[model samples]
Target: MNRKLICYLLSSLLLLLNCNKVMSASWEITYPRTSSDSDKSTDYPLKVLALALEQTGVNFQLIPSEKHYTQGKNLSRLKDNREINVVWSMTDRQREKDLLPIRIPIYKGLIGWRLFLIREDMADRFKYIQKVDHLLKLSPIQGRDWPDTKILQANSFNVVTNINHSALGPMLSNAQGDFFPRSMLEIWDEIETLQTDNKLIIQDSLGLQYPAAMYFFVNNQNRPLAHLIRTGLEKAVANGKFDKLFNQTYQSYIDRTKLKKRKFYRLKNTFLPSETPLDRKELWFKPN
Candidate 1:
C-alpha cells in the first residue's frame, strides 16, 4: 500500500475506535436467550428498550448470556453483575432497590392482568368461578424468583414455585399445580410453545389482575445508563413512536383478550414501586 493511503486508513481506524468507546463507555446490556424456549421469540421488552436507547445516542452492545440463565437466574445475575447494563423484568420494591430502575413501564400495566393456563380438560372447571375466593382455591404456579410468586401468595392464593421455566408446563399438565397465570401479551404465544402434548390449554373464563409494571433495570451503580434509557423512552413517547410501536406489536393480542367479557379478580401488589406512573394512560397496554 502507498504511504499516504496507509496513513489515512490508520487515522480513520483511530477515529472509529474512539467513537465506539464513547458509545459503550458506561454499560454493555443483555437479556437471556429464549429462541430455543419459544417458537418465535418476540422480544417486545428488548425492542422497546432499543427504541429508547436510540434517542440517547449512547452505544450499547446486547450481550446474550453465555451462562444460559433462565428467567429466574436472570434476576440473580442482575443483582450480582455490573456489566449487565439492562434487563426488563417485573418491578417491585426489592428489585428497584437492588437495581437502578428506569421507571418506564415497558409493558405498561398490562403485565399485571393475567390469564390462566390449565389442562385442556380443566377448562370447564374454572368456568363457574364466581369470585376471587373461588379462584384463590386453585393452585397457581410461578417461577421461584418471579414477583408474581410473592404477589399471589400474599393474596392468599395457593402458589407453587419452581426455578426452571421449562418445568412449569409439565408441572401444570401433570397436576402438580392446578393452573399457571400468564400476562395478556404472553399467554397466546406462550401457550403455543407449552402445549407439546396438546393437553395444556389456556383457561378462558377467569383472569387475574394486579397493579404492576415491568421496567428496564440496570446495576444499582450504573446511574448514567439508567438516565440514558429513561431519556430514550421519553423521547420516543414525545415523538409518538413509542405508542405506535406498542399498538402495532400488541394489537392482535388486545383484540383477542376481550377484557370486558372475561371475569377478572383483582389481587393486591404489596411490592409495586410507588413511582410507577399510574397517571400515564398512554404508556400502559390494556385491552379495554
Candidate 2:
C-alpha cells in the first residue's frame, strides 16, 4: 500500500475505535435508598425503571446510592445532579419546577388511594363516620416533609407530623396520632412488615381518594434522560407491558383492598399541578 493510503487507513481505524468506545459507554443511573435496607416499597418502582430503560435499547447501569438519604435529601441531590440522577416522587408544583419530570405516572395514580391504618381496637371509632367531615375530626400522622402532610392539612384534617417516616408507625402504635393514612399499594406490605407491639389493621368500610401522580424525575439539565424515560414508558404502555407489570406487582393488593366495596371520600389534591395528565383516563386506576 502507498504510505499516504496506509496513514489514512490507520487514522480511519482509530476514529472507528473511538466511536465504538463512545457508543458502548453505559450511562450510570443512580437512585436513592432509605436507611432501611429491606424497604420493599422500592422494588416495584425499580423494576418499572428497569423496564423503561430496557425498552429504549440503551446501555445503562441501575445503581442504588451507597449513602442513605431521606426523601427530601434525595430530591435535593437529584436537583443538584450530585449523587443521584433520578428519583421517583409524587408530583407537586414546586417539584415540577425544580426537576425534569417524565410525566408518566409510575404508580398509575394508585398512590392517592389511601386506607387508614388504625389500631385494631380503634375500628369502631371510624365505623360510624359517615362523612369526610367526621373523618377530618380524626388526626392522621404523616411525614413532616411529605407533600401528603400539606395536602391533608389543606383539606382541614388535623395532621400529626413527624420528621422520620420510620417513626410514623411507632407513633400510630403509641396513640400519638388518631390514624396513619397510607396508600393502598403500600399499606398492606407496611402492616405486614411493621415491628410494633400495637396491633394495626387496615380500616374497613371507609377509605380516602385523591388525584395524584408519582413520576420519575431527573435534573432539569438532563432533558435527554427525561425524554428517554418518557418515551420508553409510553412505548411500554402502548405494547401492554406497563399494564402487565402494574397488575403483576399491585393487582393482589388492589384485590385485597376491596376497593369497590369501600366507601371512599374523595378529597381535593391542591398540590397536584395543573399540567397533570388527568384527561388521560387510561393512565389512572378506577375501581369497578
Candidate 3:
C-alpha cells in the first residue's frame, strides 16, 4: 500500500477500536493487612469509594500491602508509581500539603477518639488516671509514623513508637510503654489477637478524646482520580447512603464503648489542617 493509503487504513482501525472500547481507569489501591481481619481490606471510607467508583465506571483493583509498611511508608510509595494510587491517612497540615486530600472524614471522626489498652497489671493504675497529667507521667505505645503518635505526643502525652504494628503488643507486654491507645472500633479485634500473650487489658472507665479524622491521600498529580472519588463520596453523603453505611459498620462499637458515659479526657489536636470540615457536624458521629 502507498503511504497515504496505509495511514488512512491505520487511522480508521484506531477509530474503530476506540469506538468499541469501554471507558475505564484501572485504579490500584493498597491497604494494610491486619492480622485480625483479612476481609477488612477496605476500611469504611474506602468501602464508600469502592461503591462510588462503581457508580463512576472506574475499574479498581485493591491489593493488600504485600509487604507490611507503616502509614508513612504508604504515603511515600503513593508517589509516581501506578502500583499505589491511593493511601488512607489522617489529615495533618503537612500531609495535606504533600498529598491530594479527599477532604472527607471517612469514619465521621470516630477513629479520632481513643480507648486505652494497658498491661493487665497496670489496668488499675490507668483507671485512676483521672487527668491528662497522670497519663502524661507514663508513655503510651503507638505505631511509628502514625498520625495518632504525633497527636499523642503533641497533646503532652509521652509516646513511645514501634514501627511494626505487631510489636506494639510486645512493647506493651514487656512494660516498654504503659498503654496503647486504640479506637473503640479497632480495640476488640486487636486485643483478641494479643490476648494469648496475657499481658494486656482494656481499661474500663476512661477514654481519650480528640478531634481527628482519616482521609484518602492521593498524589498531587492524581487530581482527576481524586475528583472522581470525591464527587462519588459527596453524592453518597448527600443521598444518605454514606450515613447508612457508617451506622451499619460502626453503631455497635458506639454502643459498646458507651462513649457518653465514659470519663473522656479531652485533648486538643493542634495538627488538624485548617481546611478540615469540622463545622459539618452532620458528617461526624455523635453518641446518642
Instruction: Estimate every model's Cα lDDT from 0 to 1.
Output: 0.82, 0.90, 0.79
Name every residue pair that clashes in candidate 1: none
lDDT of 1 by residue, 1-288 (tens): 999999999999999999888777754677666646443543777788889878888867677666566665676777787334568889889888878888878877888989988898888888888988888788999998899999999999888989887788889988898999999889898777675454888777689899998888888877877788899999999899888888899888977888788888888998887887888877876554
Write model 3 residue lDDT over 1-288, tens digit each, in one string: 799999999999998877556345476666554444553535765677787676666677777666655666678877654456787777888888888999888888878888888888886677667777887898889988888888888887778997887788888888888888998888876776674355677887888889988887788998888988888888888888889888898888778887666888888899998889999988887876
**lDDT of each residue in 106-181, candidate 2, tens digit only:** 8999999999999988998898898998998898999998888889999999999988899999999999998998
lDDT of 1 at 52: 87
TM-score of each: 0.86, 0.92, 0.85
How many steric overlaps does candidate 3 have?
Answer: 0
RMSD of 3: 5.3
Arrange candidates by lDDT, highest first: which order? 2, 1, 3
As a TM-score, model 1 comes out at: 0.86
Q: Sort all candidates by TM-score, best to worst.
A: 2, 1, 3
Worst 10 residues of 3 by lDDT: 32-41
